[model samples]
Target chain A: MKLWEQNIRKVKPYVPGLQPKEDNIIKLNTNENPYPPAPGVERVMEQMKLDKLRLYPDYDSTELVNELAKEKRVDPEQIFIGVGSDDVLGMAFLTYFNSDKPVLFPDITYSFYDVWCELYKIPYERPMLDENFRIVKQDYYKENGGVVIANPNAPTSICESTEFIRDILEHNQDVVVIVDEAYVDFGGASSIDLLKEYDNLLVVQTFSKSRSLAGLRIGYAIGNKELIEALNIVKFSYNSYTMNTASIVLGAEAVRDKEYFQNTVNQIIEQREKTIQELDELGFTCLDSKANFVFATHKSVPAGKIYEELQKKKIYVRYFNKPRINNFLRITIGTEEEMNQLIIALGEIL
Target chain B: MKLWEQNIRKVKPYVPGLQPKEDNIIKLNTNENPYPPAPGVERVMEQMKLDKLRLYPDYDSTELVNELAKEKRVDPEQIFIGVGSDDVLGMAFLTYFNSDKPVLFPDITYSFYDVWCELYKIPYERPMLDENFRIVKQDYYKENGGVVIANPNAPTSICESTEFIRDILEHNQDVVVIVDEAYVDFGGASSIDLLKEYDNLLVVQTFSKSRSLAGLRIGYAIGNKELIEALNIVKFSYNSYTMNTASIVLGAEAVRDKEYFQNTVNQIIEQREKTIQELDELGFTCLDSKANFVFATHKSVPAGKIYEELQKKKIYVRYFNKPRINNFLRITIGTEEEMNQLIIALGEIL
Candidate 1:
């Protein structure tokens, strides 16, 4: 019955965090920024002329790219837009990794990375994270194809230094290295600045995090023009209108409004720190997170039990039953009010 | 260099029509419908909350599918959504056609059909159309792994009767018979009704034409639940967040307002008949078109010369320099005012 490629058969689908329909829960499973996007960001959608929706979206997303180029301090030619960071990552897998060259990513990083590798039928190796659930950058440099690292890594909520990312780029000369900075807006140092020095490097970012455009499915990759061209070629071959017009417009606006962005991100950071502190004080060993989420566990309690018990109190957080982090829960940093609700629920569950 | 597949090297990169910078140029290329979308469509966009732009669009498009199902008189489960008809076609090619069975499409059909075959390394046979540029459905009963036909076929704008399509579906029980109905909303009858009798038939339609939401990228398929399941699997494995929020809302509204759609199509049909009469009298031989476009050429002049001549007057039409069709220009039918301008320009040129 599995007429699909061998890769799809062995694949484990990406499990996005649980979203509860009823509004009473303190939901923080998917690492979505609890802080709402900039008010100015929504203005772009409001301003769209629905009368013009009949025509095809501006093919190149010219204005959005221009905004991105100015925001990233990179050439417009160096940016590739996609539906989401996953779309950009999918483009990276198709464009950069051939069947002969195996792509590489951390075993414990974003689950979609593995799904993409499978879908593309590219061979890949996952270098295991250390006992502390941190990437060994030196380990990735040995005998790898393309390299990908999630900064403020998912499920672990830990960040690898830009210096280490550059080291991987330096070592992997033959293949493209993709750094997914989806959560980087939370606090992680972006490697976007390094695009000037490296042609083989692509830094993938999303407006879903800090810009709060997760609903709109807008993500982009900043790289050398040649690499960006590869993504464009793949995208053109498949879906030309990858990003919706309204989403692209809002993304450009959010990137342009630096003041609004700073204010919201500052609020999220402040909340994340307090949440992590509260969890730590309750005898949980929490990872030092640069993301708006925390991964933590206690020696006395099983992670799944805690996840379920918290759900009983109308509070939800992520619990991955995967290897290397089965005992921990990845909790999104919500607003102060939501975090307080989660903390109180956690205390009760304990 | 084409890195992955040897077949990719053979593909001529796609060049989409350049976007119109000035609004008044009588844009007719790419077969885009000339009129703007319905008034109801605009109302939905204006009413959408800008804050919703940040969140991911509904992946299932449950609401849209329900409305589409209601309109089509089919079960909601039978509806499969994709980015556009092109994306749906790409998925169909990838899913049904693989190593063992090559696809069979008409030689003069949609160009992307062949491109995807090459990209996926799926061997395909392009059966040449008959003397009148009409597809003989009997030709598909050969060794075709699958059959894809663009109804109210592109470039020619010629349509195959529902009876002829049913004959193909009735006989080709072993293969996937795909109807690319990207232009069906304009005039041609849809094969959606045939789904009850044929489990293997997949009919793909887009909101780009009738709904006038090309900028939004919404396409859907109606088929047996089994075939829908196959496409759904491919979709989930690839991009789940394919349909953004704006598209879902706009597409559903566009489908719901069938009366508005009928009015628009009737106007286009009226304009089309007038344009055809005008061209025929002006010593041009045009294909019998059932869709919203006219495929025409003057016996005295080649298509290339006409294309060049029209460019001088700022009139745009699609010309493919391929065999058999090199003499004809695919001119999308415009609004009454737009078509009058085209006629006036043609009168001056003549």
Candidate 2:
């Protein structure tokens, strides 16, 4: 080994879902929105003056924060923006998970959580989720550095109630609590309201899912002013200009077209329900899902076999080979036509 | 005080140059390029399919990296991209500066160096620059954790020779050495050629300065394949999708138009020389700058008064009120017309 290699930080980086380069395939592995961004995004992209790119974007991301504040019904000071929810959560991990105690999260949650912990060298513990893949709030009540909960957790599609979050917050008031709401807009209840009472609560949401701008890369957190301030301090210390010009301007445009945002989200929800019903008829046990995805296991067929068969037909879905989740498939809800194709592929595979 | 505040990572964040909200003012506080990005950038932005935004961008930033690799004449595996040079540098610090020993840098180098050290809790020592504000190469020859040199060092606008970088690299073979070339395209000789000899050296450059795409937020590092991999691992562990779609696409287009890139750099360099001569005539002592900006201090007038007087005339230049460099103004080279106006304004102020 090279002598300098000793100083190199060794880390097992998070593996994001496949973004298949081949076109005309049903691509639903990464839980990205299956619809285009709001119409205003295109307009803004077309009309934005290219000359202004010579200057750096506003490091504060003032306009984007103001629009998000209006949408979330929070003070502008309560909002903090990042490149995406991953960036936001990474910053949160660095900023708030500094105690000697290990931070706590569900054993099965957004995989990036522990990756952030490991990257920052922050000690963390994973409290196992119940057999139903639901967060056991009481488990988080134990003393810890902090807590992170992915509301409408990934690969499980289960969302807990605000009261459940409050229970944990009440016991863990001494540490910061991050409610990752990346999928909360997809029918799950948001814990943003809890911020009024819990100064330690930080609710992180992203435009990647409901807003259909994952490619644009915008995510934000809303919390009490102090929590947001701390997050901002960490962000500025890291990179003052994290948000680029297109993201700041186009992200606000995506937030502005409220009607289109709701329409696309509603369409995804409708299709999700239909797809879940079809899967059930095919003898697949699907978790009752609130997010824009479903977690399922076939009664007779092995998930690995079914995943292979579907992929052979150009239908993609997420399958984790890890413990407890090895037999399950996490399928992001696509458009009506795409969902139909996925259902038909699964039926044939079974 | 709040109990959770103890867990909050308190930091003195880096204050970026003021991005005034109001328009029609000459902006030079930030050393951003005055010219628009290559014309092809606008074409790409206009032609990009907005519908594809529902999906995530290529986290690897493959196309941009490939384009940059061809431009820089390096293997694709030797390159790593980030949101900007700051993000790139921040990741480098977290990845390569993990040794227990203190990192070494110039006392009056890029301000963000110390900020990153503080944020990441990396021990670092700033060796005092010579009285002429040039890096004393001997100081870095001593044992330390790692080394970071901002070629064409900021605020001082002095570019050390490739030989100077080689000397430092020859001594620090046991640790990673980061040569930040954020301003290299202006005139500075890049340490990229030395990479063939020094496996531990990593050279970072950005599109923000000479390419006139500061608003798009693209930066990269070229090094041995192993060092790039380590940087990528830390980047992926931190935020997998730091480079958004617009930045990736538009940044590639900027690279493709080599003619426009060189033209803009030449224009800025010409303007910088004329600005320096004009400032010298106005009784200002200007550094022998190889950067797009000039570091100048008035012989009789204080930098603060000149900064305020220029502001009153709707012209802005950077004036840092820190020790040792308190009386200097770092004026970015703008258009010839802008420089003339600046010279006229200085004449009147004097």
Candidate 3:
């Protein structure tokens, strides 16, 4: 080892999905929105004062927070915005999970959970999901430092009901429960309303998938004022100006246009349902997905072979090599035309 | 304390300068550039493709990194970009400074250094600056896990020569030494050249000061390939897509216009020298500033009073109430007209 590397903390970094430079490929590995952001976003960007780049952005992210609060029907004090949902979730991990006991999360959830636990030296336990890839709430009843549930979990694309989440929260009233709702806007119910009942609950959502601003990187969390305050403390300590001016301004513009947001979300949901039925007809055992993606495994084909074959045709879908889910493929739902192409490609492959 | 607050790590957050929403104020508290970003930046903003935001930004910031590599005359492998210099420095602290020995920095330097140490649970020692507010190189010769020297250090507005930095690096060859050149573009010489001699040297810089893109939040570090890789490991593990799409494109455009950058930098340096002479004429003992700011203490007046008086008149400057430097005010260099108005205000106050 190099002399400087002897004592530093080191961990294997997470590999994000391929962001192909070429434009002709069907990109579905990462669950990014397939539509453009709200029309107001473009207008705001056009009218933005380039001169303002000389000054620092608002440290509080006042405009974005205000817009989110107004949209979610919560007071502005209950909201916290960051560069992306990953940033918000990372800050949450740093702030709330500090006890000696291990935090509890689902084994088959967003892979970042374990990576974060390791980074912060926070002990954690991953309770196994049921055979159907659903969260088992009773497993969280045991002691834990905190709880993180990625609602409509990644890779599985299965969402748990809020009532089930309520049960988990009730059983563990002392620990902070972070319900990451990155995919909730597609079809799953949001846990935002439960914030009124549980002071320990934090619901994290992102504009990347639903608002179509993945490249802009705006994510937020809604919770009780105290929870938000704790997050603010951590954020300020880490990087005070986490959100830049364009993101704060354009994100607020995107949030204010409710009709555009809802219209795009409905379109995505319709496309996702159609894609699932088509995959099912091709002899794929697909999960009951409430997210913007479908998780399916073919009845007679190895997922690795199918993934390689699809890649040759410039069609990309996420295929994890981990245990218990190696045979499944997670495909992001695109526009109707894109989905039609994806179906045709799958038909040829099968 | 609330139930969720038990045994969690907490630190007093760093307080940044005020970012007032009103447009009429002559904002000078934060050390921001007075001129706008390069004209190319405005063009990039105008021609921005709003459609691409639906996809994620390049995880590696490929284009920005390539641009920076060409501009800095360094290999792309030797660069690590971040949201701001704060993010770059924060990641450096997490990646290096892991041994049992305390990290070392100047006591009266940038306040965020101490906050980052506390946040990462790294032990650190602050060596007192000499009476002239210059770094004492001998003080850093003793054992340390790592060292951070802010060239043309903030609040003090004084710089240490690269020869002095070399002496410190010679004594401590095993640990990482970060030479933060945030204000190097104004008048101070950069330690970037020393990277050829020392494998452990890391030079950090930002676009916020000389480039006039504080609102865009772009910062970078240039080091040996190994150190850059170490920072990348930590950054990717923390947040893969830290740089948003706009920052990547606009920051690169800002870097590409060499003539514009040099012109603005020269203007700032000229204004800084004039501002120092004026402050000296006004019975203030101003430090020999090599930065875009002037640090001065009035011979007969208190800095706190001057700060408050300037605030009353809609002119803002930074005043820290810390020990040994309580009388000093760090005034950011503004345009010639703005500086003249500031001089008039100071004359009346004194």
Candidate 4:
């Protein structure tokens, strides 16, 4: 090995879903919202002054944070914005997961959790999810450095109740508990209300799923002022200007049109219900999902074969080959016509 | 103390230059270009499809990276992109400075170097610059984990020759050497050509200063394929989509208009030389600067008082209150008209 190689920090990186370059394909893999962002976002983009590109963006991201604070009904001091929720969660892991005791999460949850632990050298343990793919609240009740729960968990497409979250929080009050609500807008209940009682609880959300601004890369966290201040300190230490000019201005527009935001989220939820019914009739068993996606397994056909067969028909869905969940496929809810096409494609594959 | 607070990664953040909110002020603190970005950037923004923002950006940032590789005459595999030069440098510190041995840099270089070291818990030593505020190349010849040098070092506005950089690289062949050329396009000689001989060398540059896209937050690193690969791994591990869609698309357009980039850079150089001449006549001893800024100290008045006086006249310039540089004001070069106003204001204050 080269002598300089000894100083290299090695770790496996998280592989985001395939974004096929080809235009004509059904892309339901990454859980991105099928609809475009709010109309106000388009208006903001059109009217944005390109001459301002010469100046550095506001390092504080005041406009976006103020808009979010007003929308979420939290003080501006309670919020911390980042490039995305992934960035927010990554910063949280760096800031809050420094103890020697292993941080706790479910064995089957967002795959990025463990990757972050490895990158920061934070000891972490994943307790197994129940057979129903539910986040067993008791598993996180033990003494640990910290706890992270992905409500409306990915791949499993299951969201635990607010009471379940409270149970975990009540037990782990000594450590920071991060509730990743990336999909809460679709159907999952938010733990944000619990923030009134727990200072250690951090509720993280994103623009990628419900708001349809994944391409813009905006996300934020709402918590106690002290917790947010700590996150800001670490963030500024890392990069003072994570948000850009267009993101700050356009993201504020996304927050302004509340009616358009609700309408798009409602459409996704309605389509999700209809898609689930069709999958059930096709000899497929799907978990009860409160997210923008569905997790289903055919009674006879292996998910790997079904995934490949659907790909042949220009339909894409996420299929993780990890242990215990190999039989399942996570399909994001697309438009009405797209969902019909997906149903037809699934029937043929089965 | 709160139990959860114990795990907080506490460190003093690197405070960025002031970005005043009020308009019509002579903003010259952050080293930003007075001119706008390339015309192609404006065209790209006008024609961008808002609907495509529903999908995630290309994780590889293929288009921007490919364009940059072609422009720099390097392979696509030899480049890494980030939000800004600060983000690129911070990632480099995390990826390459993992050895137990201390990293080496000049004491009077970019202020963010020590903050990054503290954030990552990396042992680092700042070898003091000579009395003239110039990096002594031999000081980096000692055994250390890595070396970083800012060509045309910030606040000091002093540029070192390519031969000086090559001398440091020759001795530190076994460790990674990062030549931060954030201000190189103005006049400083880039050490990018030395990448051919040193496998461990990484050259980082930014669009904020030369390309006039600070508001968009675009930066990149060019180096050996292995070194670039390591940076990509760490970037992906931290945030898979650090570059958003607008940044990727608009950054490519900025690179396409090479003539506009060169024209703007030439204008800034011309303004810088003129400003230095004016400052000299005003009883200020200005450093010989190759950057878009000039570091000058008044013959009688202190830098802090001069900074305050400029601000009172709505002319904002950077003043560092730290050791040695306490009496020097780093003044960014604005347009000719703005510089004339600044000279008039300084003449009155002195």
Docking class of 2: high
Measured by lDDT, the strongest candidate is: 4
Question: Using Cα atoms with residue i matched to residue i, what is each candidate's TM-score against the true structure?
Answer: 0.95, 0.99, 0.99, 0.99
| Interface RMSD after interface superposition, model 4 | 0.7
Instruction: Give a tens-digit lDDT track for model 1, residues A1-350.
Output: 42223111233445566656676667688777765667776576667777667888877888889999998788999999987887788777767776465677888988888787776577888889988888887777676557888897887889888898888878876677889999998878999878878878889998878887777788899988878876788777776666656667777787888998888898989998888788888879898989888899986899999988988888888888987789999888878888888888878878
lDDT by residue (tens digit), candidate 3, B1-350: 77677945688889998877776788788999999999999999999999988889987888899999999899999999999999999989988988999999999999999999999899999999988888889999999999999998988888888898899889889899999999999889899889999999999999999999999999999999999998998888888899999999999999899999999999999998888889889999888889999888999899999999999999989999999999999899999999999999999988
* lDDT (tens digit, per residue) of candidate 3 on A216-244: 99999999998899899888998899999
RMSD of 4: 0.8
Candidates, DockQ: 0.46, 0.88, 0.81, 0.89
Clash list (residue pairs), candidate 3: none
Q: What digit string (tens of lDDT, one per residue) describes model 4 on residues A43-137? A: 88989898898899998889999999999899999999999999999999999988999999989999999999999999999999888887777
What is the descending lDDT order?
4, 2, 3, 1
Question: What's the lDDT for all of these models?
Answer: 0.80, 0.91, 0.91, 0.92
Separate clash counts for every candidate: 7, 0, 0, 0
Please state the error at residue B184 of candidate 3 in Å.
Answer: 0.6
Question: At residue A14, what lDDT does model 3 achieve?
Answer: 75
Give me the runs in candidate 1 sitting further than 4 Å from their true place.
A1-12, B1-11
TM-score of chain A of each: 0.95, 0.99, 0.99, 0.99
Q: Residue B227 in model 4: shift from native, Å?
A: 0.5
What range of 10 consecutive residues in model 1 chain B has the weakest lDDT sum? B2-11
